[model samples]
Target: MKLQIDRIINEEKIEIDEVIDFSNVSMPVKIVEPVKIHLNFENLGKREVRVSGEILATLRLTCVVCLEEFDEKLKIEVDETYIPETFIENRKEERPIEELSEFTYKGSYLDTFEIVRDNILEFIPPYPKCPKCASKTEEI
Candidate 1:
């Protein structure tokens, strides 16, 4: 989702709670439901912002052992700081090492869809197992 920096700068903070559609996007796994996001964005001054939130979604995954399709619920927590693109150029030489790890926004907006998508992808289990198989393995 794309958020306007101007709004956060003007209001100092904003809260968002909505469902994001990703039907058109390409993903490694099937997303069976809309992504639900609940976030708070706070301006940290000097073109820096803090984003904190939770993302919820259901994904369709195939069990590695049984080869059956099953739904998996994902809950991802987000806590990130964002710096303006101009901040990098202005302080390229003086930028601290820690600052390099922070996320950057271009121009007047922050598009977090990619970040969210990546988080979702990372949350997937590499070797997924259906509930039945998972329980059986646990007893072994």
Candidate 2:
């Protein structure tokens, strides 16, 4: 879950390859398998890091209409900017509230698993429906 970025401080880009087990962490939705995440962390400047990656997993979803359990392939795009605490502390008042996509980190290490899990979970449908249920509802 911990991603070390010390090596990439000098390099322009660093590739992070990890297979994360999210069973231990409390997730918003049920997951059926481990997530495969591949990411690239690029140093934007002195204290900013750009994280771009792809996540793939299988999620266990319950159909809201039919009440059936089904597996769904979850794919998510990871794109975010991380700013150091030092920078945020100095310019917190200057930055606009609407620019909330930036994440703040205290140190060199980042919580890769947690960040990716949160982004992926946001894509889940609030009221999921199975194929049969969806088709039936369409005819009504």
In candidate 1, what are the lDDT values of residues 2-83, reduced to their tens digit?
8889889999999989888888889999999899988889999987999899999999999999999999999999888898
| Candidate No. with top lDDT | 1
Clashes per candidate (backbone, < 3 Å): 0, 0
Q: In model 1, what is the error at residue 17, expressed in angstroms?
A: 0.9
lDDT measured at residue 63 in model 2 versus the true structure, 0 to 100: 97
Which residue runs of candidate 1 sit more than 4 Å off their true CA positions? 88-101
lDDT of 2 by residue, 75-126 (tens): 8888888888787778747778765778888877878877777777787988
lDDT by candidate, in order shown: 0.87, 0.81
Find the 10 residues in a row with the least total lDDT in model 2.
Answer: 1-10
Overall local distance difference test of candidate 2: 0.81
Q: Per-residue error at 63 for model 2, in Å?
A: 1.3
